[model samples]
Structures are given as structure tokens and as C-alpha cells.
Target: MRGFAQLLSGFLLEYVPRRRSLSENTAKSYRDSFAILLRWLADGRGIAPDDVRIEDLSRENVESFCLWLSDVRGVCAATVNVRLCALRSFASYVSFTEPAYLEWASALRAVEFSKSPSGEVEWLPVEAVNLIMESASSDAREHAMLGLLYDSGARVSEIANARRCDLRLDAPATIRLSGKGRKVRIVPLCDQVAGMASAYLAATAGAPDSPLFVNRSGKAIGRAGITYVLKKHVAAAHEADPLVVPPTTHPHALRHSKAVHLVEADVNIIYIRDFMGHSSVKTTEIYAKISSKSRQKAVEKAAANLIMGSAYGEEDKSAIMEWLRNLL
Candidate 1:
């Protein structure tokens, strides 16, 4: 007989953080999902959010919410699936805590995840990445940020959350990145990037605990801010050469580009997985697949060009076939 508000508070404040040990970002995403759902119920079903009860979270209403998200809000399938997952997790939590709602939870869990397309991963070529870096070369802070972003292959959040103490500019320089699930990994930096980090740090000395990257206002740059910095450089690179930098270049593309480059260099898949902070090698295999496909296309194109350019006719083909048969 617990109210919806009471259950949601416990699920988000305690169960998600304490029991599940999820990160703040994940908790916030879940909270936003519920907020959207509650607003939908209030506006559509005329159910006041505060007056809503556990019984109001019926399977039909949950399914309708998914539809409304797609049709009205214009959200993508992946986003819809994330919202569904949040509700499913909340229902599961309720089932465990309040046995009386076990049936309700079961019904809610029956809701299917929205089907989402597995689109091709977008990445930039090495030349394009270098061009983007060159565009930011005039600004020391931007150059250092771009260097760490690509060399470390860290997500925007990981780079944004980095502290001054996380950097090591000594021999075999590396930076510590905190990834999802609060996992920390040390990623080595190339000599060029290491030097950039050293120079940038020396120019702007701060407390060891202070953020490694900060805005002009002396505040720690958030993920959006990092994206803005990247886009600004990307625009400059695009103006220099329209073909080099795509208009849609974003921060995650740098991470993907690093992974793709590693795959092309014949780096072991397991090593790439760990380097990219991927949870499994299966996730890392996508880069290998992309590289393989690119090679296949190149070989096919070369074979086609050779055949078309050659003067070989039926007589030339017969002679080649006879020579092959004799050798066999």
C-alpha cells in the first residue's frame, strides 16, 4: 500500500546507489526517466504526480509511455529502451521490498524493450584527426585537451572528471581515467601528448585536487563544455578543408577513431578492449570488423582496376588457364 512517491524515492536514493552501486550519472538518468514518466501521467491521464499510487504503474500505461516517447517526444529507440530499463529496475526493486507489489512488478517487467538499429560506428581517419588537432594548435589548453582525448581514448566524462593529481608527466607518462562503474584505468600518453600535458600544466599551475581541464571562468568543464571545445576546433578544421572534418564531429568520435586506428595497426583485440575501457572483448570486436571490411573493399577495388586496365582477352585468359593447369 506504499505510495508511488515513497517507492520511487527509496529506489533512486538507496536501492540504485547503495544496493546496485551505480554511478551518479546512471542514477540521474534513471531519475530523469521517472520524471518524464510522471509528467506524462500528469498531463495525459490527469493523475497528479503526488497523488499517483503504486497501482497506477500498470503495464498498459508503461507501454503507452514508450509509444508516447517515440511518437510525441521524437526520442530514439535507444533512449526509449533506457527509459524502459529504469522503470523495470524500479519495479524489480519494489517487488523485493514490498512483496504485496510482486504481481505488479512482474507485469511491468513483461514490457519489451524497443527495437533499435545497430548503426555503423562513426569514426574519423588519422589524417582527419590530425587536422582537427592542428586546428587547435594555436591554443595550448585546447591542444592539450585534444591530445589527451585521443591519446588516452577516454570518454568525455572521464576526461572532464580528471584531476591534476591524475596526471603523471614523468618518464612513460600516463593519465588516470575513472570510467563507468567507478573503475579506474591508467592510459599511457604518447611523447608528443605527454609534452603537451607537461607544458599546459606548467603554464597553469593549480592545486593537485583541482580539475585538470577548466573553462575561462575557472570552473571545471563539464561534458557539454568539452564537446563545445571539440566542435569549435572541428569547425576550424572543416573550414580549412571541408573533406577532412565532418560537420557532425563530436567528442565520442575521437574515442572511436582511436579504437579504429588501433585495430588497423594489428593491435591485439584483448589489449584494445582494455585500452578502450570496454567491459568485454565482444564490444571491442566491432572495430576489428570495421577494419576487416575496409581492407576487403580495398582489395576488391584493386582487383577490379587491374582487370579493367589489362588488355587480356579470351586468348590471354586461355593461356593463363593452361599455365595454371600445367603448374598444378
Candidate 2:
């Protein structure tokens, strides 16, 4: 019992952060999975979290928990898969401590990740993004943050962790964004975005180490803060032009919009992949697939430039037809 407590505490406190050095979001996800499992064990099995022995974490318990997540909590397949992944990771760690449970860890790991339904990638139109940016012009911080999200196509986490030192507003301005799995990438900023960032920073007058975007309390803006700014402006843009901005507009939609716009501009997909900090071109290809405007343009171009029949002359066509007739 004491050993189980030590294992859970050490895994969450030391192993995940110190050994794996995962991002805060990733750590929270792992912690959340354990918390949910603890709650389920207490509620469903009448077992307290700390009182549970290592033997209690059986293969049956894991599968039961997965079903509870889907049937009781009503979580999506992707979310269920995420919790399963966290459980599998913990099970593997347990194997290292208790060699006797090697088979148990293997059984838990054998559980398959559920398949999720494919859906169209949601992205805003150019006019919609423009309207949202215009709506945010009243607040320089919001404007700059929105512009940066669109221009750089950074994930919300990357934007939240941005610092004043990350910006380089000289000629050929760029910002360094740290993405998932601690991968850092340099994204070039457009002139408009660069100017906005410059003005906002100058007004804020923070040290290089200070957060780039702060809330009303002068504390660093979090993911929720960024989402709030985006949602507020999206509503305003919709009010101004109801048809332009969609109700589903989000900060990540700005990232998607930027990628789709780049694809529409005939930019090389590889460059877009690098610019967006995607690990693979396959991930970047979703934007090209979702760019209906670009696809329509391609169809129109092909239709407008149709060649009038084959280049063969009438005599050549006749001779071919005669040869075919004779052979028949």
C-alpha cells in the first residue's frame, strides 16, 4: 500500500517533470488521467485512492475505467484514447518497479486506441480574419496577439509561453515559438504583424524576460485569456458582418486560416509545413485539402484553357479510322 503511494507520487512529481521533461500541458493531462482513475476507483469500486494496492490495478479495472469514460462521462473517442495512453504510460513505469507485473503492463498496453471520425478542418476566410483583426484594433494587445496568431500560425500554448525576447522586429522580422514536445521554430512575421508587436511592446515597457502579452492584472496571458480575446473579437466581427465571421471561430481557427490562405497563394506546401511547425507534410496537407477556393480556381483554370480536340489533322484522323475499320 505504501509502495503504491510512493510510486504514484514519484511518477507524477519526479518522473514526468524531471525525467521526461514534458510540457506543463502534457503533465496536466497525465495528472488528470490519474485523478479521474482515482475518483472512479473511489466511487465505483468503494476503494480509496491511497488504500488501493498495486494488485488492484488489474487489466479488468483498466478496461472498466475506459468504458466508464465513454458511457458515464460521455467523452469523445480521441479523449478516451488520451486517457488510455496516460494509463499505458503509468503501467509501463510500474513494470520497471515491479518485475512481477510485467505481464499486467503488457496487457494494459495491448489496449487499442479508439478511432475517431474524420471531419473537415475548420478555418476562417480572409475577409473574416480581416474583419476580426479590425474589430480588435481598439486594444493594441488584442490586435497584436490576434495578428501574431494569424501571421505565425502558432498553437495557443506557443503564444501563451511567448516572451519579449522571442521577437526580432528588425528587417526580416521573426518570432521564436516553442511548440509541443518542446520543439522550437522560428516563424517570420509579416510587416503588419511586426509593427503591431513593436508598438505593443514599446507601450508595455517590459524587460526582455517578461511575458509578451499580459492580462489586466499585468500577469502573463494564459490560453483562456487568448481564447477570450479571440472570441470577443469574433463576436464583434460577426456583428459588423454577420456573414463574414462564423460562430465557430477560435484562436486555432486563425492558425488554420493562415495555413489555408498560404496554400491558396500558391506557396510551396513544404514551406508552409516548416512555417507552421508541423512535424510532417502530411499534417500540413489538411489545409490544402480544405481550401475550397483554391480547388475552385484550379477547376476554373482547367476549364478556361481546354484544348480544342487532338492536334492530329483531319487526314491523319481519317487514316486511323480507315485502318481501324479494315482491321475490324
Candidate 3:
């Protein structure tokens, strides 16, 4: 048990941050997974977290843990799979540090990830996005933040972590976003968004190193705070027209909207991939597929309207057919 505690500590504290060089968000996710697992074990088997032995992490227990996450906690398959991934990573670490648990690690690895359905990516249409932006016009910070989010296609964390020094408001304005794995990508800002950002910056002057967006208390805005800001404006937009924004709209929807708009503009897939900071073009391809579907729907609607609205009688149709034959 002491061995398990020490190794677990080292894996979470040292290996994850230093050796793996995972981002802070990922490290926190792993920590939360383990925390839930420990609490579950403590409740079910009456074993305190410190008293948990390495042997307790049998394949059966891990499977049951996943089931508990799904059935008891009402979490989805994707979330369960995330917890399983954390466990598998820890198991690999155990296998390397202590060869005696090699078989145990192998058993844990054998646990399968739960299959999750591929759901449609939720995104706002341009009109809806414009409505939401307009709804937040009263607040400069909210307006600028929404504009930046839609313009940059950055993950919420990247926006939350943005600093004043990262913005370049000169011609060809751009903002530097640090994404997963601490990779930095510079995304260009549109002139309208750039203007909004300029207004925001002038209103709230701070050190270059200070957070670009701050909460009312002058501290750096976190992911939750960002989400709150988005939701507040979404609610205002909803009041104007309930159909314009989904009730559960999140910040990621803006990112998706930006990608889909880029696809509609006939942007190159490679450029869109880099713009979205996606590691693979395959990730960007989803937007292309979405765009194709949207276009097909529009075309189908237009075709249906043209056919249904036409006032051609049987005689007129026959005349048109005869004309077509003659032309051919």
C-alpha cells in the first residue's frame, strides 16, 4: 500500500508534468480521474485511499469502476473512456517503475475503452453568431471576447490563458494562442474583431504580462468564467429570438462555427487545419463534411421550392419536353 501511494504520487506529481510534459488541464483531468477512482474504491471496498494496494487494481475492479462511472454517476461513454485512459497511463507507469506489477499492468491495459457514438458537431450559423455578437454590444469586454473566440477558433483554455503580450494589433492583426502540448499558434484577427479588441485593451490597461481578459475582481478569467460570459450573452440573444441560439450553447460552438465558415469560403483544408491548431488534417475534414451537408440541404430545399412552385400544367410540361427534344 505504501509502495502504491509513493508510486502514484510520483506518477501524478513528477512524471505527468515533467516527463510527459502534458498541459496543466490534462494533468488536472488525470488527477480528477484518480481522485474519483480512489473515492469509489473507498466507498465500495471500505479501503481508504492510502490503504489501496497495487493488487487492488485488477481488471475486474477497473471494469466495475467504469460501470460505476456510467451507471451511478450518469457519465457518458466518452467521459468513462477518459477515466480509463488515465488509469491505463498510470498502469504503464507502474509497469516501467516496478516490473513486479508487469502482469497487473497488462491486465489493466486489457480493459477496453467504451464505444461512444459520433455525434454531430454543434455550431452556430453565421446569422446566429452575428445575432449573439450584437446582443453583447453593450459590454465591450464581452463583445471583444466573443469576437476573438469566433475569429481565432481557439480552444476556451487558450483564450483563458491569453496575455496582453500575445496580441499584435498592428496591420494584419494576430493573437498568439498556446494550445495543447504547449504548442503556440498565431491566428489572424479580422478588422472588426481587431477593432473590438483595441477598444477592450484601451478600456482596461494592464502590464504586458497580465492576463488579456480578467474577471470583475481583476484576476485572470478562467474557463468557467469564460463560459459564464458566453452564456450570459447567449441568454440575451435568446431573449431577442429564442431560435437564434441553442440553450446549451458553449464556447466551442464558436470555434466550430469559425471552421465551418472557413470551409464555406473555400479555404484550403491545410490552412483550416493550421487555423484551428488541429494536429491532423483529418480533424479539419469534419468541417468540410459538415459544409458539404449544409450545402446539400440548401440545394435540396431550393430544388424542392422550384419544382413545387412551378405552375406548369400537363400541356406546358409536354411542350417543354418537346422543346428540349427539338433542341437536342
Candidate 4:
């Protein structure tokens, strides 16, 4: 029997990171999923991770592990699905490499993922966004960071990984974002954000290789650090404007605000998808559904009778008659 430990190590160390070239954060998440699975197997089946064989990974055991993640560990459906995905991916690798484990791998692959709820994206109101921007203007780093976040709509990890060389701050300024799966997309920066970023970069004496946003120690800021900066300004904005600003908002809220604002501004959905580095247009359509103008238009189309009924005879008589003709 093939040692599960060796296979697991090779999968994580060789395949995921080296072969697939996934980010360290993603690799860590996959590693953690397997760790939880191993712990469950030990507790439930008296199988140590190192001692477990390929034959132990039956469909029943895999289903039980997923159930334990939800029922015993109290993890959400999304988390369970993530674990299932990892297991399926590993099973696929095993099926290709070791023909003897093909049946077990097929069983693992047959396991279905749990259905997870799709939560609505939370975005800040325009007034609240204005207030936050105004407050951040007092601090150069915060101003630049927040401006870039709103203008580029980059993910937190992408923003954190941003280098000074990625910025094209001259005319028609743009920044290249390193997206998931090693994909790169260039997002244009608004003039206002470009100006802020230029000034902040100058003030910090940043070089082409230096991180765009760094802590006082001159190290690149992590996700937590960026979140702290956002939280600080959110608190200030909330205190300054209690009615407009939301009391609880995060960095991603700024990204969501940018997407919603773009949809409200009558920007094309395709352009927004490219700007936001979304893999699918379906992801970009969420912003359209959330836009107040889009919702208002839908409402008006639905309730046209209230406005048109009063002047139906004079204004829309020809169209109404045409519709009546068609119905008759």
C-alpha cells in the first residue's frame, strides 16, 4: 500500500505549489483542509494520517468526513465544499499516478459538494465613500491605498502584492494586477487616484522594486495591516457622519463600492468585468443587479401604468392601439 503521508506531502509540496504555481495563501488553505480531514479520520476511524492507506479512502469514509466537518466541527457549507474540492483534486492526481487506486479515486470524485448560500455583496453608499475618502486625505499612505483600492477594484491580496513598477502613473495611468491562477490584468487608474499615488510614492521615496504599501518597518503590508488601515478610517468616517457611513465596513467594501458605482454610471458590463479582473461576466452582473439605478429602472418598467395611465389617451394611444390590435 502506498504511504498516505508521502503522497500527501508530494501533492502539497510538488504538485500544488511547484506544478500548479498556486499562491502561498492558497496552498496554506489546501494544506489546512487536509489537516482537518486527517484529524477527523484519526478520531473516527482510528487511522493515523501517516498509517492510512489508499484503500481507506472509500466513498463512505469521504462522505463521513464531510459530514463531520459540517455537523461536528460546525463549519459552513462553503468550507465543506472547499474541503471536498481539495479531496477531489488529490483523488484525481492519485488516479493518474497510481492505477491500483483508480477505484478509490473514482469514488472520491463521485462525492458531491454541499450547496452553499450566495450572500449579497455589501457596498458603501456614495456619501459614505466620500466621507471615508475625505478622512483618508489627511494621511498620505491611507489616501493612496484607499484611492488605489477604489479606482482599481483590486483584491486585498493583489493590492498587498502590488509593486511600485506595476504603476503607470503618467497620462492614461494604469496598474497591472496579478490575479488568481497567475493571470495578470491591467486596470486604468482615475486621475485623482493617480495624483494621490504619485505624491505618496514620491513622499516615501519608493523605488521600482519596492512594495507600493509598506509598514513603518519598510516591509510590505499584509492583509491584516491593510484591514486595520481601512477599519481606522471607517471608524473615523462613521464618527464624522453617523447617518451616511456604515459603522462596520472592510477593505473589500471599497471594491464592492467601486463596482456598484461603475454600474450606476452606465459603464458597460464587459468593461467592468475586465477592470475588476473577473473571470466571468456573470460575476460582473451582480453589480448591475445591486445598482440602485438598475433596480429603479426595473421598478419603473414594472409600474409604468402608474405614470403612463394618466396620459394614456393622448401620449401612448398609438402604441396602446397597436398592442390592442395585436391582442385582438
Please list the C-alpha lDDT of all candidates, in the order they appear.
0.85, 0.81, 0.85, 0.81
Sum up the clashes in candidate 3. Answer: 0
**Number of the candidate with higher TM-score, 3 or 4:** 3
- Once fitted onto the true fold, the runs of candidate 4 whose alpha carbons sit more than 4 angstroms away are 1-118, 292-294, 297-328
How would you encode candidate 2's per-residue C-alpha lDDT over 138-256 as one tens digit per residue?
88888999999999999998999999999999979999999989999999999999999988887788899999888889999999999999999887775454434544356887898
| Superposed model 3: Cα runs more than 4 Å off | 1-118, 303-328
TM-score winner: 3
Candidate achieving higher lDDT, 1 or 2:
1
Query: What value of lDDT does candidate 4 attain over all alpha carbons?
Result: 0.81
- Ten residues in sequence with the least summed lDDT for candidate 4: 297-306
- Give per-residue CA lDDT, model 4, range 181-258, as digits (tens): 989999999899999999888888777988989987999999999899888888787545443555556788889999
Better-scoring candidate (lDDT), 1 or 4: 1
Q: lDDT, candidate 2, residue 175?
A: 98
TM-score of every model?
A: 0.58, 0.55, 0.59, 0.55
Task: Output the lDDT of residue 201, model 3.
Answer: 96
Cα miss at 129, model 2 (Å)? 0.5
Candidate 1 local lDDT, residue 18: 86
Query: Residue 81 of candidate 3: its Cα lDDT?
Result: 72
**Model 2, C-alpha of 70: deviation from truth (Å):** 27
How many residue pairs clash in each candidate at the backbone level? 0, 0, 0, 0
Which residue pairs in candidate 2 have backbone atoms (N, alpha carbon, C) closer than 3 angstroms, thus clashing? none
